[model samples]
Target: MATIGTHSGAFQADEALGVWLLRQLPQYESAPLIRSRDMEKLKPLTIVIDVAGTYDHDLLRYDHHQRGFFETFDGENKAAKDGGRPDVTGPETATGEFKTKLSASGLVYKHYGREVLIRLHPSLSANPDALDWVYRKMYEDFMEAIDGNDNGIELAEAVRYKESSTLPHRVHRLNARWNAPKDGPTEDERFETASALCGAEFGEMLRYIVECELPAREIVETALRARTAVHASGRARSKRYELERRHGLPAEGLVQFVLYPDSSGMWRVQAVTVEGTAFTNRLGLLEPWRGLRDAELVARSGIDGCKFVHATGFIGGNATYDGALAMALKTIEGGSTSVELK
Candidate 1:
């Protein structure tokens, strides 16, 4: 029977998530979890996280609090070990250098994330590309924050105000409060609460990636491939009618705008919904032509065969495909009329 061990006090997101990730593996699914700080109590455990003072991948010991310990996703002490390798840095962080200060959760994820993802969603196991994409995307979207917060890495320079709503902060609050009743939940109980919270969030993220985001990627890929057919300018189109029926894809922030031919045979350049789950485009038509229509829009845009540019600039219709392409291109280029219209 395998066993996992961690510190016996209030658990942070790192350890909680680390333990949850371990449980996802078949070897550790039913393993007994012992929480303690004493070395003797942890001696028999197969894995130790967040409390052991040493980090040895082969030995399955993960801890980050030890002095002079610098391990990253690519391994340990990457900058010094690799002599400043150029590609060691990941695209997600853009830290400009290797040697990310990893937390216990990060160490576990770095080693077993892909395997865990495949276990959670077996369909992804067959598609190496999708599995790889989800593995990296999950780290970027979820795990990096835990690693960064645990390591005390300044996410960004204090521009104005600090961000208060982070996952690590929320998890930290789950611990039994200092001012709570004297007979409140025990440390072990609080640890279990944290584990459950982290595990629930982790499962929800996996479900979203597998159910929603993955299918959306397929649509985005298809749209990218058919961009040339939409217009010669090569701008991707999320055909509202098709996407709405097929996947109900959210277009606003996810997609800039969609170009489709209107019922009048004129091509329409419609702005996607930016405010809510509706049909309002965030980057509406240029300011100058906002309240203008038909000929007035054509005059300001310097494009012919113009049908109408809505007063709110949420949509515009042009008589020809070239005209709609010009509108979309000009809008994306920030109202620049200098684009060479074909």
Candidate 2:
């Protein structure tokens, strides 16, 4: 959670202004810029500039290697063909361009052996002011995370074994060491601390991977539809199998949510299914989500598809088209004791 700007070398608030000004250079202002096929050959220099501050300088000063961002591509820079020389090479510096076809393109930064790609929203169109806003905003959020970060317990520890040190055991031991109530009251307090810690940790990790890492803006709509289908299936065995067949869902995983009482008695909301592809297909089978009274279910599944689609990064409205026959699951449970007594 340590912020990029907190480090001694973090760009000053006004540092980005110089880079911003350089970005404003007209395509026709200079000779055509150079191009490099070897992405590793190009080095990225990051300047954290606060445009509102007292900073003013050329956004890009000449590197001895003769490199700058391409404003217009006539491909006329002298170093483009000569395999541009290294501008600054040593233990502290390495070279690369921070370019990604999916998003913004810029210089790649290597600091303390870690490589981070600097990018922006494409709609921002590489505008200096927009970049300024993004840098400051990111810095602010980073600072906030450092301030209010939560450390939670996980549920997976319940089953995880230990070889002197396993996941749940390790987690449980850590909890007892750090969070056991000093009052030393009842045995229940010990259980509560252990349980809560594990559950919270697992939930936090789950939420991070599911919510933030997944859910790309592009496929949000498609995922919503897929999720609706899964929600409509209920617990019907055939529906579950059919969904699996159609969506290539996994056989195992769980979804958890609190139950709420309604006009129909207590109802369980579809929080988020832990199963990946299997969950999608399960939902996929429940299509035409009309008359679904549970808005939470509807909303959850509607949003579920977006999560799946984003995670997989696959395109095609044909999520439903990829169907196959479901194999029946055989079970051997008999009638209840009440039935036998009757």
Candidate 3:
């Protein structure tokens, strides 16, 4: 049976998650684990992660502790060994080279994520675009934080506040408290628990993405394709959008607002945020029109049937489809009176 190796002492989320990610592959699914720092013992294992001070993909040894280990998921694919040669993908991180360096979990994820995702949801195999999107999405939505935190990279140049609600905190707490009797479960045993924790969380995220987010993507895509038919911007429409609390598609920089019907049967003219950002918008609705409702909003924006615009301007609602679209188009065209519903 193949054997996996890692340091035997304390464990971090990177190695815990790395161990779990490797097992997602068929070859390593049931492979035995050896937790030790002894090179003599590690030499014969099928893989070693987060230890041994080496980061060679060909050898199946992934460690980020070595000197000169500068790797990142910079969204540019490059050759691993040479680092300078650009390629579609190296055996290493799927992203050519990114601004953020990856940890053991990230390294494993970058290489084998697409495969794991396919296994988790077979339907993704048929849609290459979605597979690619999800691979990056998983990193942005989940793995990047693990990679950054494991690498000791600060969220900001200066820490503004203590953040303990993140996944890393959970993983860190799983470690047998420092003063506990050694008679408790061994480090190797606790490692299994940690890996399972990371795996379960990751699996839940993958589940939500495939089950909930992807279906919504279809609606957004259909709405996007027919945007020019509705308005030149295609961003402000009445049938498909509610991305304010969710993610919008990676539409480059074209979309500005997305008007979709809300659950209340009202049409929403939601502002499209800058891709990859939380709330910064590409363009927001007119300022004077915000915080107004009903007659005031209709009178202020000069668009009939306007209901209300959120004070933040991230979203607004209209009683009718035409009203919402008109609000969307007016924002895109800079409040020009000539811009009217076609």
Candidate 4:
């Protein structure tokens, strides 16, 4: 029965995302949305975002165009006359004070984004810590760019070249061009297109954080906690046997290189891809063994059971667990000199 009001005419990513976020809530799932600037029509609306001349949270009015309006997530500078101290302690303020501006999308996200995420994935609600972490991480990774752009916060002191491929720029291009034909799509149609564009991007980002990045973090934390069990130096680890089926995640989720006993009764060391996706390793084997094999590798490294190191320095293997552990430890210790085994 409630109505959501935003500005009419060309829409920006801020208002588009703001409206989309509101629709995700149960109360507003099917609520009618009115785009108008007339106060008379907006007065009866349940919530107004990005257009009203006021920003009263009690009344559900979210706008940032007013003068002397700087609000952050943690209320660190919400009351300061000049945006408060730059050293405020908070995830949003960890970088600096200039990042405190909250646009309409930011306002909605700060207030209700976590609930929205949980609604999308009910499993996240079970883990309060994961939910909290993803909430902050989403702000840092995705929403901050939208907020900064909408608030006109300069990211750099100066720019030597212009950039046209940013998400905002691409969304803006969805509008009717200056040279568009008179029979071109109407302003409302253009707005719908832009809204869909922004909505799809927002959904994709949420899915990635929820399904991919968050799970990888847990795997990494588990491996880091149990690192000492794999090697005395705590520098080598092999989750190939321990965490293989536990989370349905590959061993590469945590370590740079893994040491495991091969099927031929020989121990092997192999590089773990970064983040389980990148080609680069978290840490590479020593340079001396790189591109060498068999006798050459064994002679240069002076370690028994020495195998070949990849030419790209991403991986290596040895014939024994101790040899693999030695290689992993030497690489972790900067690989400047040979490691003396006990």
Candidate 1 lDDT by residue in tens digits, 222-298: 88556557655443366334344354444422344577786668888877654323544546767686667788878
Q: Report the Cα lDDT for residue 204, model 4.
A: 92
**Residue 330, candidate 1: alpha-carbon lDDT:** 80
Tell me the spans in candidate 4 whose CA falls farther than 4 Å from its real position: 78-98, 156-163, 233-328, 335-342
Residue-level error in angstroms, candidate 4, position 26: 1.8
Model 3 global lDDT (CA atoms, 0 to 1): 0.77
Arrange candidates by TM-score, descending. 3, 1, 4, 2
User: lDDT of each structure?
Assistant: 0.75, 0.25, 0.77, 0.74
| Model 1 ranges off by over 4 Å | 79-99, 236-285, 289-326, 332-342
Q: Candidate 3 lDDT, tens digit per residue, 1-342?
A: 988888888788888988998899888999999999999999999999898988888999989776546567654234444555433233254445356778888888978889899988999999998898788778878998998898877877776479997878888888899797979987778889999999998999998888888787787766666667887645554232333223443443266777778898999887755545566766677888868999998889999888898776778899888888888878877841211111
Clashing pairs in 4: none
RMSD list, candidates in order: 8.3, 22.7, 6.2, 7.8
* TM-score top scorer: 3
After best superposition, candidate 3 residue 245: deviation in angstroms?
Answer: 23
TM-score of 3: 0.82
- TM-score winner, 3 or 4: 3
lDDT of 4 at 16: 84
Error of 3 at 104 (Å): 0.9
Per-candidate total of colliding backbone pairs: 1, 27, 8, 0
Model 2: residue 14 alpha-carbon error in angstroms: 15
lDDT-sorted candidate list, best first: 3, 1, 4, 2
